[model samples]
Target: MATPYPTPISLSKTCIGWTDIGLMGSPMASHLLSVGHSFSIYARDPSKALQLQSKGVCLINSQQDLAKISDIFFTIISGPPDVCSIILGPQGVLSSLNPGGVIVDMTRNHPALAREIFKPARKKDSWSIDAPVSSIDVGAREGRLAILAGGDIIQWLSPLFRIMGKHMYVGEAGCGQSCKIGNQIVGSANPLGLSEALTFAERAGLDLKKVLEGIRRGSAGNMIMELFGPGGFAESLVKDLGMGLDLLESEEERAVALPGASLCKQLLCGMIANGDEKLGLQGLVTVIERINDIQK
Candidate 1:
């Protein structure tokens, strides 16, 4: 059966509040403010938001203060714990969110936590939607992210969603996080496979550029190869994969099998051990090289 989506309402007059003005969130909030959303921000590290403030975005001192002024709150913090702290904490957004207000959490969090947030929002006559985005720094800056929304209120938030990225209404609360976990699982596999292949070709003394060209034109061609060709940070990937594996372990009934993701996690961990956690996904090739004793 199809789930019903609320009709999108005009948000022309809605006041928006955003938090966590980091690499991804900064640009996302900028896009909103650029489009004239009457935007405000609550930044823990105020320095990160100085430019936004200079551009006329109201920088509130606390989430409580933000809640009083914002009709719609958007957060894209680091993990589940921070999500809880910002939304459910003593001075969190929900502590004083106006009735009929909405909270859109764009963090890639545990699915269960997303659902946990939904209940209180309902009790207060507000709404919580989990809408994790899939994109890197450039994509976020360019507003080209792929957003996965898990809630019925998505339609009502369509105007805002359109500015951030292309969004898919997945299901009830928490489903967006679940889908993002699956996305990380699937996304991790491609880059790992590409890195392995590249490492092999390099070890065989093949011309890497020629080999990459052939791969790009061949059956193994994929978006990961195109976007990263051979580079991306392993730290974020490690966190995402760890969360994915934990989710699988917790859901015993599902019995899903994804050995590639596990192996990818291991290789990424190897990258971290080698002190290359700050390096890109192509750095995984170094791990493979290390395994074969091929010095860079």
Candidate 2:
């Protein structure tokens, strides 16, 4: 049986479901509860579901059950596979969601699949919303995440997104995912830019601490400095934070492959990311030395 096609209908009767309740989704759903939207949840790990239960969120046994009951569906899983399993999988949410419900995915995932999820959801006359959240775990808890919602279910979604976080409607589905990747591009470069600037200051024999004080006063200041703290770009962060070696390698690949970054800068980035991220962007200093060593 096919669901009646909607002319972008608005939904006031809302039951929400969260696929993953860890990190961003936990606090995001918490904010939803605070605003009085009763939400059901499912997590791969029972403990995560239990944590949401302790916070008064309704916990369900399966993804299908969540869809059957929820007027709004949301997935915050880590990547593409989890997205497919919960939605397009045999026991997926689309199988159970009532007609005219809304499905919202809050994961950073491949855009094409997100767009494809809309088809079956629409076959049942349900709509899918791509609204991957922007912000760290800290921002999620603070209710300050920036939400990027796609699809024409704007009216149905606006009030709910308002409760969840500060938000912006990017476009239709996939638009949200596009913006997320764009953000990653800029985000990868922030620390690198800081590293180069600080290196230049140090090579000039300028005391970096004093230089930072002056730069922090002007346009040179940025969030990268704050994330790395006073050591600026040091190797300590990688060992301490447990950031992935693969991600650093990916950073180098993207720099060389991505449009806009100067080739010289890309080569420099490739070397630095290939080396170590904890060493801060300043790790480039060693690469620079190696280049001169080769020349000599």
Best by lDDT: 1
Error of 1 at 117 (Å): 0.5
| Stretches > 4 Å off in candidate 1 | 1-12, 229-232, 251-253
Weakest lDDT window of 10 consecutive positions for candidate 2: 237-246
Query: Which stretches in model 2 have alpha-carbon errors above 4 Å?
Result: 1-13, 223-257, 260-296
lDDT of 2 by residue, 1-296 (tens): 12222432233335667878776777888887776666678887878777668777777789998778776787887677788888889999888878877778888766667788987877877788788776666678887777877776676567767776777888977778767655544544565666566667866888989987887788877765565532312332222122222223443223224442233245345554766444444454455545445232
Score candidate 1 by TM-score against the native: 0.93
Candidate 2's displacement at residue 250, Å, is: 19
* lDDT measured at residue 99 in model 2 versus the true structure, 0 to 100: 82
RMSD per prediction, one decimal? 3.7, 7.2
Name the lDDT value of residue 103 in candidate 1.
89
How does each model score on lDDT?
Answer: 0.84, 0.66
